[model samples]
Target: MKKEKTVTMGVDERYSQWKSMVGVLYDWLANHNLVWPSLSCRWGPLLEQATYKNRHRLYLSEQTDGSVPNTLVVANVEVVKPRVAAAEHISQFNEEARSPFVKKYKTIIHPGEVNRIRELPQNSKIVATHTDIPEVYIWDLETQPNRQALLGAATSRPDLVLTGHDDIAEYALAMCPTEPFVLSGGKDKYVVLWSVQDHISSLAAEAGSNVKMGSKNSQKATESPSVGPRGIFQGHTDTVEDVQFCTSSALEFCSVGDDSCLIFWDARVGSLPAAKVDKVHDGDIHCVDWNPHDINFILTGSADNTVKMFDRRKLSSEGVGSPVYKFEGHEAAILSVQWCPDKSSVFGSSAEDGYLNIWDHEKVGETSGSGGPKGANAPPGLLFRHAGHRDKVVDFHWNPSEPWTIVSVSDDCDSTNGGGTLQVWRMIDLIYRPENEVLAELDSYRTQILGTTP
Candidate 1:
């Protein structure tokens, strides 16, 4: 019995490693070989369902009691949805469309409630936040079931505003993990800092905020700009793709861009990079992220088809100038990468290949054989590969509450497949024991410098 158990465990480990290796190959083929877009599953059906009703964004927030909270954020584009423009497009699709299915498909999320939303802390609210091209807002999940936007409750207000690029916002905004401040970045080539107090007040005074293309709401009716932002951070040569604050320190943050540079910033001091490495990737560095458990570590994904990890502590040392570990396998550009929060040494990367490559740290030598090990004991080795996307994957988001769930976004074609589609993967289904209890408490108490939350 003992021997049999050991064999089973070994097979599982080997399989995990193989999956990662295979994923790299798939990414390479999808990116470089130019697979027919028609070869993948069509996203038209799913996207139509998502946008049928008046919904633009959907979010799931789980309660502590195991019940889940789901909310939809709708942008009132003069009614009849944005695509309809007038009643003509709506009528045409209904009458001339090839498909004959019409249910509240928009309301019912396929694959149902996401596993990433495990449970919210006691009394903690599930908030859905968005911005109107230039303006940012948050919606309280605890409010009415009608899914109203929380106009007055945002934690921050941005001094800089950019609606979107090519019809979509190429960047995303995030609330600093520790403060009421908000961080906004995108193809605009600048990362702007927002003040928390200012955001809440602006929403309260104005019934609704209009996010224009170039101008800001400088004219306040009654309140000032909540001490305003310290100042805007502008250094990226290209569009700022991503930004993240250190989980352990508030003053430390990171930003990556198309210029092939990953810059570390000290919010308390200078505007220039405290530390920077130029040409960090062969191509644009589209994504940068900090390890949730280890603040000193960071990850970057690039158009070079590789993911690299850097140890800040090591980078800050006397003369070290290169990444501590580099993982290479994908053939095409990598759009996104994330570290698994629930477990250490588990990370994933997504690419144009429409697959996810799970990785682990190891040290191994190059072997003159059929191919490299799917996963090895080096700085980064492929562990698992999940193929789910049908086209070029543009974004990947990991669930904070669930251990193995990941949500991805990709551009489909026009008509039913136009715009984009979201892919939710219940990775737990591929794991061993599936019933691990998720605890909300952290292993150590980190200082909360900004927010009023206890």
Candidate 2:
């Protein structure tokens, strides 16, 4: 299938975003009374909706000084005071000021999945978050006519929901692009196929709505999406760390786990794996991603401290047991690998090494005997590194719609240190600027707190 491409951002557009995000972070930290031991943060919807704007922010903050606290606070930076974050992150606030009933969607530490879904006549946004508990909460993040409602909707009961998996917690979830299905993998060694339409309808019924949102034949425009576990996949003997749908097929998906194997699955053929590769890596496979362009090309990062590429088309070809391409670069176990959603040529990896590196699949040259990459494996596809976090980079995402904008979340390293785990970053090259917006927002809020301080 021929793919349609769009114009990538020029240096000017990237520069402008770099200025906006950096200034926002500096201002946020320099002035606010952020809660200590901060857990998670993310970009929020704009308080004032523009006709069709392209940027967003708001967050949870750690204190400016080195002190760490145990409580969590959801601040909505858009409304001047701290606004609430999504449900799980905002459970403890007072009822009067409570944003939405997001409490029901509580989740623990896991990669946050924000996706741009186009189920209707136009595109919208939804964030799928996993918790330590069994469920994954799918909150409708943005609705077309009203963008300010994003925060409110995120806190309300999720638009779609799934619960079984019981005791085993889910670690990864990937939504299929062309269907109403989502794949979930977890510690239980089970992969579930959930129907978004069923989940949404469940919510609608609970609210006592007799309204028939759309015709039974229509796939979109429903009051609540279905949450049915339409299918179940089982094969791995250990914890399933990650699962991703094949870019080329709607029914086919791949799952990797602690069992040291990678299994390619196809729903059409039932629960059995279409292709199975045992001992795929030396250790537990932590993450897996299908190349945006080459559906047969799969990328896997592992506790073995190596990143390996597998080609299903060549599974029965030469080096049947070995990877098509294995690149070793990280000193620590690689936790995440993301093939840029916008540019098929580039991909990024993050790990315990506290660095995020970008690579080009086509330009990568020869590797050492141990399957590790040497210097300058490729060029201009923008092979580079960002050493911006002090702690391990848990997860990172290349904004689906914007190739240049990147966001990463990690564990905290303490406030005095100038780095972040819960942070936003860009691949664009821009000079760092000074901070003064705190004067307009947080500083004013704080000054009001310590009025006329000596």
Candidate 3:
């Protein structure tokens, strides 16, 4: 007994000594202003010689995510600036289009800079952003500045406004498919639809024709646009998570929430939901999106680690029939799910597991060279995956005009803010590359660097 106790004490002492030494080293590093390097991060490369040294070798790829691309880097930028007048065609596409339009920017974000305003274009005038608090900000890359707008609650308390949400809780926001209305859901358990055109027209009416685009004096003329609520649909018993307009009609929309229910609302109807189902899932519904091609079809991601497809006609406030299709391969919460804008059978899901998984509901499974799927209904096998994020994926969307392109954002490791990046990735590269080929390429890259596969 004595011998054993002595041995345990020696081991504990050694561990304590090692821990203390490590703490000392850590403190020393902190004192010297050192930080461990991260795998990757989003950065905009500047073309100006003064912006970043050694610029000739590589152009800062537009908004490239912090991923080691197979060959090159590309990035995209979401600039926060005042609106400009509707103008001639200014395409924001690949590098070819960037050269002509991006050159007009006065202040260019640099490598060492965060989202700070380092400079502005020569002709640009700064606009004040005091009273114009926005709840949700959306920028249409295709039309960009022309369609850029803000959304906020009409009845707001300055003390209660959160950065991205109004009131106590924010559930969802969706743009109308064919109309000028925007729908928003909240912890208040009400879905409100606001007319976009009305907000703009009312703002213009207030400006009294004195507002000039990009003019210094225009800030006073175009104060906060009154975004009074248009129509309110009330039915949910819990917090709303997502709300989306049905693709086929402007009069219809859908919402989901922590109540483990989904409700369909009609803008033209009463406060009651047009359709509702509280038994679709065993957990909170995190997101819901209508199929772009099918009005009856909608896809939902839930906290139960599953994605369910519902046929709206078969569901009501009472109950629902068997789902049209169900997917259950995610090991963590399904945070975001989106149907491919082009393909009816194809779609994608982003989860807390840090993977972007693609699926085709019509296909039972797919066989890779590794082997066939272990089960007939094993979630159709991942068509491809993007596991580059280091944390939970918060949301994602397919580029409005680009079918094969997608963008995903996630929660940061600290959970203090978002993934802190707006990354762009190509679905084609992930879908087409065979497993073996991808492995070989990754292995080659590792060997070329460290002389061993990582």
Candidate 4:
């Protein structure tokens, strides 16, 4: 029998080389560690728990440097018996009734769907109660309470919860990035700016209402509160489907709707628009968003299968009819459009076609055209195509903190999640390769040097 001798490398040289490599890798990891986990893996528990909170609430807040971090949860609303009409406002009313998971119970008259939701002024609290009802539920993210106040501020509850003209009551609610006022647009073609100070005053009004409900021995009307409507904005010929407050100017905001026009108003003035884009779209404008990254740029999406970006600086001199850039590719109408908070040149648009188009504004050409951006041989890139929903995607929102993260919700025409479902996806999904070729190259180099697959 013959014995084989094993060869060994210099211990100090090998140890030094491995330690140096680890130090370099550690530095890279320290600078670019992944804060966002794999979308499908980490969000499963959150989505399962979503059954309790029915409504998926995604909240985004801008940091001092202008980056936005987003928070999501099953909206913490009560999951009473299916028969209760109040539960209908949340989600999956009919589906839950038929689902073998829930027990049967009594039912009440159905209420309207959510009109709008907003974060409270000056605090971390968020509210999403209906306008038609007397009660407005308020949730304080700071507290993480099981059940917060169903009734907002102590003031007298509103008698009429307003809805949009075409049954879309939450036509638009614009919150000033730096101020406390939120401008709410309604079905009546009117816009009202609700002041944060006025909201606190509402608390006093609520206390007064409680005193009236109580006997003499009860708590006195704590404080007398006086609130005033900033003024009603009136410009739209039909319902104002969306409204936005300019981040650059606290005194200005814009509204758009079925009219195919975008009306820019100085909120400090009466309802009239300071400027208008009378022909921005050929069809109904579904959504409007101001560029948080570039205060002077505005973007809009329409039912006509088009997305347009207006450079206010250029518009001021070029006139209202011109758009700095227009995008067109979706076979169906665009349902929602949102701009990246970190980069003004990059934006994402979602449509009924079930595809999300990301565009680099810098590369998008400005050639005169009849067919729009996509048809005209423009450089608009298809960042990614996501197709999980069996039906139309209602909304697409970008995670402010994570530039590449987007969350979307859709209707289940086939009742996939029993009725409707919310899906969270990473923009990285559009670009993620299962295997990193660069990492493989590095591994091969190490194998040759170390004489093993280290």
lDDT per residue as tens, model 4, 224-340: 222345667778887777788888776799888888888888966666777877878999998888988877888899998988988776655323658877776676788777786
TM-score of each: 0.55, 0.62, 0.58, 0.59
- Per-model tally of clashing residue pairs: 11, 22, 9, 15
Weakest 10 consecutive residues of candidate 4 by summed lDDT: 37-46
lDDT of each: 0.47, 0.54, 0.50, 0.49
Query: Candidate 3 at 140: error in angstroms?
Result: 10
Q: Please report the TM-score between candidate 3 and the true structure.
A: 0.58
The TM-score measured for candidate 1 stands at 0.55
Writing each residue's lDDT as its tens digit, candidate 2 over 1-454 gives 1221121223234334433343322211111212222333433433343343233333332322323221112233222112212222222232123222111122211122221111210222444555555666555443212212222233233455566564555466777766666788788888877766675465467656643333232224343343557788889898888888877676989999999888888899898777788899999998999886878788899999888888787775322556877876676899888887766766888887766677666556524111012234423232655555545666675644433556565544432234333444443222111135534454667757778653
Position 63, candidate 4: lDDT: 11
Flag regions of model 3 displaced more than 4 Å: 1-166, 204-218, 221-223, 365-378, 414-422, 429-454
At residue 26, candidate 4 shows an lDDT of: 18
Please identify model 4 stretches exceeding 4 Å from their true place.
1-111, 120-124, 128-168, 202-228, 316-319, 365-379, 414-418, 429-454
Best by lDDT: 2
Flag regions of model 2 displaced more than 4 Å: 1-53, 57-124, 142-156, 200-226, 317-320, 366-382, 413-420, 428-454
